[model samples]
Target: MTTALSPVDPDSYRALMAAHPGGVAVVTTDDGLGTPYGFACTAWCGVSLDPPLLLVCASTTGSTLPVLAGRGWFAVNLLHGAGRRAADAFAHRDAGRFSAVPWRPSPATGLPLLPEDAHTAAECRVHRLDPVGDHTVIIGEIVRTTTTRGADQPPLLYGMRRYATWPVP
Candidate 1:
C-alpha cells in the first residue's frame, strides 16, 4: 500500500526543521588544493556506535560541499558556548573562516580541527554517501575521537534567530 502525501514547500520544511534544536559543528577538510575549507553545520548527528559512525549534511550549492564529497577524510569540531563568533565566521561566504581561529591539522585525517572547541573532535573517513533532496548525507566511520572536561562553559545553541547559552544550575 502507498500513502498519499501533500507537497510541502521547501521553505516551510526548513522552517519546521529550524524549530528543532540541534548541536552545531564545524566540518573541516583539506580540499587537496593546498587549502583547508570549513563550514559551520548544525546538521551533525551520531549514526552508530559499533563501527563508530557519524553524519553531517552539506548543501549541494555550498562551495566546500564538493571538496568534502570528494575528500576521503574530514574532521568535526563541536563548538563550545564561546564559539558563536567562530561558527558565524565559518558559516559565511568569506575566506577568513580559518583566519580568526586557532586550529591545527588533525593527526589522523590531516583535516583542520579546532583545538579550543569544547574539547570534542572527531576524525573520520567517508563510509557512505546518499543524495537526499538538495543536500548530501555523508556517513563517516570514526577513526579517531577526543573529548575532555576541560572547561565548564555552557554550549552554544541556535534556535529561531538568536544564539543562546545553557543556564547554570
Candidate 2:
C-alpha cells in the first residue's frame, strides 16, 4: 500500500530527514584532468546484492555533481567516528577538499579511495541515474571493496544539528 502526507513545507521535509540519523561517506572520482573531486554525502545506500548495486544522491547545483555523474567510476568511502572534519571539508564547494584528506587508488575502478577512517570502501561503476526532486540519484555497481582497520569503529552519524557517535551497548 502507498501512503502520502499532507503537503508540507520544504523546511519540514529537511527537518524530517535531519531527524533520521545517517552514516557519512565521501564519494570521489577524477574529473578527467588528473584532478580529483569528491563530496560528503549522507544519502548513500545499498540497493542490490545480485548485481552489487549502491546509490548516492547529489545536489543538482553541486559543482562535483556533474563530474561524478559524468564519470563511469567512483568510490564510496564510509566514514569512521573520527571523520567528521573530513566530511565537513568535502561537503563545501572548495578546491582544498582533497588537500586535507589522505587517499589512494582503488585497484578495481582506479578511483580515489580514502585510506583513513574508511571503515569500508566500495569501488563502483555507474549503472543508472534517476532525477529526484532537486537531486540526482546515481546508482552504481560495486566492483571492489575493502574493510579497513576500523571495522568495529562506530560510524560518524549526522542528524538534526550535529555529528554523533553510536553508543556501544
Candidate 3:
C-alpha cells in the first residue's frame, strides 16, 4: 500500500547517515591561476567502470565549487590511515587548509594532489554536473591516476561523527 511520507528533517538525516561509514578523500582543484582549493569528502564513489567515471559531491556554497566548475578539472586524493591531519584540515571551512597539508600538482590536470597524505590520487576532467538540493554532484572522467602507497596501507574512514581507519590484515 502506498502511504504518505513527510519530508525528513535535516538533522535526523545527518544523524542517520553518520551511522554509515565511508572512505574519505580530499577533492582538490585550482582556479586556473596559482591559487588552489580543496575539501575533505566522504560523499564520493566510483560511478562507472567502462569509461572510468567517479562522482563527488560538494556543497553549492563552498568556495571551491565555483573554481571546480570553472576549471572543469579536479583530483581525488584518497587518504590513507596516516592522513588524519589532512582530512581534518580540509573538512573545515578555512583559508589555511592547504597550508595545513603538504601537496603538489597532479601531472595530468595540474590540480592539487596530497602526495604525503593520499595513497592513491586520480586526476579527472569534469563530465557533468548535477545540482541536487544544497549540494552539487560532479561526475568526472578520470584521465590519470597515481598510487603512492602500497596495498598494505589502510584507508581513512569517517562515520558516527568520528574518524577511523580500515583494519590492516
Better of 2 and 3 by lDDT: 3
Error of 1 at 149 (Å): 7.3
Q: Report the lDDT tens digits of candidate 2 across residue range 92-120.
A: 98999888888777766668878786789
- Per-model RMSD to reference: 2.3, 2.7, 1.2
lDDT of 1 by residue, 1-169 (tens): 9899898998998788788777778888888665888888889899999999999998877877788878888888888788787788887878888887888776656788887764588889999888898888989999988774534777777777567777768
How does residue 64 of candidate 1 score in lDDT?
A: 79
lDDT of the candidates, in the order given: 0.81, 0.86, 0.92
Tens digits of per-residue lDDT, candidate 3, 20-126, equal 99999999999998699999999999999989999999999999999999999999999999999999999999999999989887666679988889999989999
Best by lDDT: 3
Candidate 3 Cα outliers beyond 4 Å, as residue runs: none
Candidate 3, 95: how far from true, in Å? 0.8
TM-score of each candidate structure, all chains considered together = 0.88, 0.90, 0.96
Candidate 3 lowest-lDDT run of ten: 145-154
Which segments of model 2 are wrong by more than 4 Å? 1-6
